[model samples]
Target: MNKRKIEVCLTPVLLPLYDIENSIVVVIDIFRATSSICYGIANGAEAIIPVAKVEDCLNYQQTDCLLAAERDGKVVEGFDFGNSPFAYTEDKVKGKTIVLTTTNGTYAISESRKTAYQVIVGSFLNLDAICNYLQKQDKDVLLLCAGWKNKFNLEDTLFAGAVVTQMGLDNFEYDDSAYAAEDLYLQAKDDLSGYTSKASHGKRMQKLNLEKDIAFCLNHNLTNVIPVLVGDKLVKM
Candidate 1:
């Protein structure tokens, strides 16, 4: 049998270089956005509508969907909340739809939605579940990191690395980016939180006094829920 291929795109800006035609694209935004999505879904959110722009999220305010918009790591002035995982508790998200827009995560989803065979949200929160799901798909995989402002960020890359490592290297043919990500994962696997604390976004979160949110986002296997993009919204799969 032919081995499935796996590649990692370090930033949204580099997404165009990869051919996503037959690949399952997993969008990673470990700082908060994707993490919150997983938490919300696990908490029973009906669905999450991810829009590329804050203005798009605001447009949903007239509907029953909860509006969430984040820019520069802070909640937009008029939104209900930012991308913090704690804000996605069952009490708030249950049985309701959430419209989310963030600095990098939503943009990454918008770009990948145009061509990938399938798009799914991935993060440390659902690490093992995602790996198991990918192994069953028998398709090439693309780990697309929602880097800070279209530039590479360590947390997203580290989560990509974790997924590649968890999936086991022997199962698929992978590229240099995959190997590099695995190498990074191997080096930091023993101390994910400690190692990623040095990331640029990590420092920014610290400055914003969001250390609790950082800790929550980095925790592994918090839920088995995998958020798959169905049309414009993400629903549990």
Candidate 2:
């Protein structure tokens, strides 16, 4: 056996336990959160500086940069945009600097950077491309999910499962929770749009009237740009 391990952790709680030294960290925050950040970079946004606090984004915006953020599935006050894919157009984001903050996603991204050798954002939008990158790297992998309000969210875990399945690796270990997530994704892969509409986080977005954004985020393999953390900003790798 090669002793390769694949660990899927729920949030900051399990984050510290994982030995991410020299490993690749796939941070997932489906439901139009991190997916929007990936799309922003893919569409030519210069870089994204993710902040855990809304105040931090506001402070950064003082430097004449664009600010985008969300909380409770709604756009934060005085922000240029919310965490939505439709907002990331070439006209708005191309060659621009984006300082973004979200309820749960960006915080996870910021925290994982400390332990991860390379932190990459993962979502349904860039599934195949991310998996392809992982295939070329030999390091251990940790799939970190930005769960809802400090609890496990289905969409992030499902996205992780999608990655595991797409990679098609046999030399890996899956905890019971990971197996459950993988199984959920396997069942939902055929109809991701339908799956998201029913997921807990998906329903939350639905109630907020952003159902279309959810659909866009669930569209798999739509991009090849891998957004990696470079210093304080996330740029295309």
Candidate 3:
């Protein structure tokens, strides 16, 4: 029997199911995590190693990796950069190894490592690239959303909808929340942020004066890099 592609929405409240034995895990944290990775790879970061904790990223700092981490929308005390796309630049990141840890996205990715055959990070910036890759692969793909502090967020779900819609999967099942996200994405169409930013995480980022970041995260297909997790790092493919 063909394995089913799963769409799992992960929040701090819902327990993480990272048992990725043979599936592809597409981790989505649209507010910043995936967006930053996309920026880093697009701007020329040779590879991004996504660690579960700041210490893991730090361990690599002595080696070839440039650390980038954030907690609660702020830079971690000792990382090289925070979880912001703006930090990645052609001049700074080109040919560099970026080690990243984020409050939600990294943790979600780490958890997904258990079950996914391959764990790939996803964002609106690389939407088309991700979809195009998935279309050619035969594995059952899982869409994992890194929700805010254990609560469901709209932006990640909308991204999931955008992905599933574009893939045109024939055998798919949506839980209540997944269906809601799909419906919301359709309702919003091209105005993604307007549709999903109603979530607390989006509002909090905006409150912190990051409306531009929100807009940037909502732009579909702006980048061509597909960040795939290799062993412990997410590298451009």
How many residue pairs collide in each prediction?
A: 0, 0, 12
**lDDT per residue as tens, model 3, 1-237:** 553565656463353443457667788999999888888888889887777787777777568768888888888886778887888878889999888888888888888776568888899999999988887887766788888766777788888888777765465544555566667678878776676677788778877898887887787788888888877777877
Lowest summed lDDT across 10 adjacent residues in model 1 is found at 165-174
**4-93: candidate 1 lDDT, tens digit per residue:** 899999999999999998999999999999999999999999999999998898788779999999999999997899899999999999
lDDT score of residue 218 within candidate 2: 75
TM-scores of the models, in the given order? 0.98, 0.95, 0.89
lDDT of every model, 2 decimals = 0.93, 0.84, 0.78
Candidate 3 runs further than 4 Å off: 1-6, 12-19, 169-177
Clashing pairs in 1: none
Model 3: lDDT of residue 214: 81
lDDT of 2 by residue, 63-93 (tens): 8678988999999887888899998878889
